[model samples]
Target: MQWVSLGDTGSSCPAARSTVAAFRSWADSYLTQPSDELGRDGPVCPYVQPSIRRSLLWLAQVPAADPRPMWVRAIVRDALEIYPELPTRNGSSTSVLRALITVFPNLKDHTLIDEIHAEFKTKFVERGSMLGQFYPGCDQPGLWNKDFRPLDAPLPMLVVRGMMTTDFPFLLDKPEWADAYVRKFAPTLPAHVRSVMVGRLTSRPALVPAYEVRPDDESCSTSS
Candidate 1:
């Protein structure tokens, strides 16, 4: 379960070499470039280029030929444990750009990918991280374009990254999740954006003004 740099080819899994190659190709051709389908002005993932340049992107391949749910869960838990130790540039400002992509090369049961994502998402979010599921024929649509499946990828995989201010959409519907988001980013968000977030919360919690909190303190004890 060791995480490797994108160029590493030392894995023992039979498909690991090819699967990692495919991921690298996809990343260079699709993720690092902008697409009309995205309905936006930048690369598919705006952080990807910087992640690559800073050498903060790492990949791990699950060796199971036919992965079981319990095993995949275990792998995901391992990944969560490994994420915080990943390297970054400029500290917190660029740490959100860091990513760990865990690939399931031989998994054919794509539905299990979704299940694993649902099971681990809460834990990841509470730790100030986001978990994303990606697989072929994935139907999860892009935020800006309904027809675009930004989550779709050639192989089944889960990705983890430090949550960013732009993740409000994912947090807005759930009160607890929204509170976590506010506690993490409230000090950095624009006033209008904070207003919009407050308006969208289902049950708004009284947020202590950011000024009252120490600048180095990223978490708000009162918000939780």
Candidate 2:
């Protein structure tokens, strides 16, 4: 995990400084609101306000890491055009997140990067009795099926971190996403982890075909 300086707001325009304040405000109280729509309760979110406030700037201005151990290493960006003028979405909430990957696709522990973006998207679109307000472009139903998700978020933001081996089960239902998962993670996974993924993937006919594994193929070998 990277060291995170919680209360530091390096240099910023007056406007950006204020935006950070607004974000922190939301993170403190608004995020804690009990939303039957979000399945969120009054308990403060574990992500914490300071982390969200400084993360956008941190991407550009991350100083050398401190020599001490840290609790969490994460990246965040505001897509609302509200603060720090980070990045405005052309409609898709995920545009900023995907753009980040396009710019720096390879990072240490690629798992964290994939995990955060993928989970956020999934959580936003999820529609049960629990979550319904996560939709992004409310006026534009063309962006997503209205029957399922209207796609709206109170604050447009994306948090990113490495993907974890435990998250493979969630990706198995999405073919393109699953293939990307295999490409990014299969190369670095522990031998045991790889073997488990191969076993699980072979039974998931809906998603396994994209990896194109065969009994004789070396590319998908668990030993590799």
Candidate 3:
């Protein structure tokens, strides 16, 4: 919904700008739909579809050094909100996550997705009867074990990038540059949360040698 001027149009072609405008229009139309009517509508709701489109557009617009904007969170939340059946949205979450990764590949780490999954579990799953709201035909534990599990690895990096970009500024002195740094890393962190990513990336412990194995190493074998 936020509109910023495309400064320095010299480098961009007219066709490209037109395409961008078209995409934005499409997204705007999608987000404006009524939530109550989304279910009776079908697989592709006008509201939800535009959010997905907007997500992709925003991701393309992001600079390599800058973290994604806070607006992106709302965009994603809106996308998820349109569907009545949790299963449909939950399943689409995977696609959404994948789209994010395609934009920011560094977010391939499972740790980030795990955090999002945990939040979903705490927010929705803990409420017992909320199960039907997410998935129509499936049970809670089954959905958790199946769809949600596989989704963790491939979730979109852009979503994590947006989270970090939006939150990191309040936590640091050089908020602007720090946001850029966080985006570059595609870290799954809030603005104020200190990330272990740098430490993990830089620090390596000396590897100890494995115990020498003898040719007839009976100790190594387990007795049947």
Candidate 4:
């Protein structure tokens, strides 16, 4: 029999070409498989799992001296896309704020910080309102008696006595409701100073009107 090298015969040698063709056919058959047969537990495909941490770290490490890079914002938005659940956590947004503050000290300026704080407060108020919609307990009226009067006393004593007379009964009857009220109320504050003032007012024993207890209402009066 005459021998023909597979390379020299090029496309014309059936025998030599058949063997090469057969090998390729077999290799391709062995490599290709039904998608269902592939194990799901194997490492996630690279195209599916982007390196979120590395990108975030790189953004964090950017030189503070340079003006805030446009890429950092893009990376942040990308990271949020990769992990959409991040904003749901209470501290997660605050952590991002702290990171930005570190990277851009200009964020600490009173005007800028106040603006950001106001924006966050607005978001929190909106969230609280949404929560109130789902949980109507957030909007319920005071269960205590309005006519009940605390004894006349000094300023602090009068306040305490008044709360005991009006707000304490309901708060005591429903401590969980009191707590929910506090949480729903606190987020409406636009500034730390306003928050402090609101906290002082809410902490006193005073009956907040049902209408005034809406998620966004920060002004609660001592009287019903």
Candidate 5:
């Protein structure tokens, strides 16, 4: 498989060799331990701030799509982006998500994108919140938590990929989002799939029913 060096910026998936090794090392170290700061039991990047910094830098140029699809593969690749230069006060997880959503159109797959986003939110945000709290009583994430530090990783990052069919539930809830979703996914749907979606969207009754029925007048039928 052809690979590009980090920052080389040619085609895609261009992670440098050293950067990959370094990321492996950092991931092994940080991911191996539980993060006490956030009162969580998972790898916390901030615990090894510098290591995460270097990894994020490498991720900036590495392509998010896996070669299997681009070329055959088992693991799905997800894109990672960082906004390090933003002003301290201006940086937030919301900002990262906005940036990610803005770029979603260009990517090839979005299922992984949603998965990655949810992963971070669950691991970092929901782990110790009312969703995860106990004994003291169920409280909202912000108050009553020890530090309220889910999105506060060592770096601000967003994972993104092409959108997927499962996204319809989220998109179809709103008229505007549904409209946009139709425009985006319709062109790619099979004729039958498109017909089914259009049928549902337009609130048209299905043409076929489960059981056979007499044509208009059952009395007209003659018994053999």
Candidate 6:
């Protein structure tokens, strides 16, 4: 639950500070700039620049030397508990720009990190948040291009942020996840996207969401 601004990680270990510094550089140079290899005409992460400008990006260190699964899970649970209290902008669409990165500098087990990410991602999505797992040499591929690895950061960390309509691609494959997306964005989804969701829902009639998705909620464009 120990959150710190990128500018200061008070009393944090040298390893923690070093990891934070590396992430700062990565966000500044890589995330905030466009790359030809990315197969898109924007930065690696479009929200990053606004996030940095608004001072909504935060970092937390899990100073665990042993890296046991139970202990790591405990820190992650704490992070989830505090995520709602993190700073956010005034507009509903603006909340998605904020991010909380929980770093595990001392953890050497990349497999365990992946396991934890997989185990917790559902819970995050259910709560209207997205959790991203990043570690050195991670093989997860980029969205627009299969060859690009957008998530291979210099450290092992989990990032949490408010979910946006742009996340529909990630949710469409899973019924419960798609249900969550529909619950939040059905009212504002573009016609094509709604058609896709309707097709998906009809295909699995038995797995339909609990609520009768009504087209009445805040407006969120596809670009959001």
Clashes of each: 0, 12, 9, 1, 7, 0
The better-scoring model by lDDT among 3 and 5 is 5
Looking at model 5, the pairs that clash are: 68-72, 68-73, 109-161, 109-162, 110-162, 110-163, 124-150
Residue 159 accuracy (lDDT) in model 2 = 35
lDDT of 5 by residue, 1-224 (tens): 33222233343343344434444464466444655554545545332343333222223322444322331111112222122222223344222211111111123443443444444433222111101111112222321245554432222224222234434544433344455556655677667756655555555223323223446665556864
lDDT of each: 0.80, 0.37, 0.31, 0.28, 0.35, 0.79
**Residue 82, candidate 4: alpha-carbon lDDT:** 30
TM-score of each: 0.83, 0.36, 0.21, 0.21, 0.25, 0.83
Badly placed stretches (over 4 Å) of model 6 are: 7-15, 89-94, 204-224
Per-residue lDDT, model 5, residue 179, is 52
> Model 3: per-residue lDDT, tens digit, 80-120?
34222222234353222112211222333334333443334
Regions of model 3 farther than 4 Å from truth: 1-76, 85-106, 124-224
In candidate 2, stretches whose alpha carbon ends up further than 4 angstroms from where it belongs are 1-6, 32-34, 39-45, 49-151, 164-170, 173-176, 179-206, 210-224
Candidate 1 structure quality by residue, lDDT tens digits, 71-178 = 888888988888898766676644887888998877888888899888888888888899999998899989889999998899788999999888887877556677
Clashing pairs in 6: none
- True lDDT of residue 76, candidate 3: 38
lDDT of 3 at 167: 29
List model 6 lDDT by residue over 1-224, tens digit each. 47676645565566677777777888898988999989989888998888777778788777675577897788778777777777676655447777888888777778888898888888888888888899889998887999999889887888988888878878866777887887877688899888877776766656764423445453345553
Q: Rank the candidate models, highest TM-score first.
A: 1, 6, 2, 5, 3, 4
lDDT of 2 at 155: 33
User: What's the lDDT of the predicted structure labeled candidate 4?
Assistant: 0.28
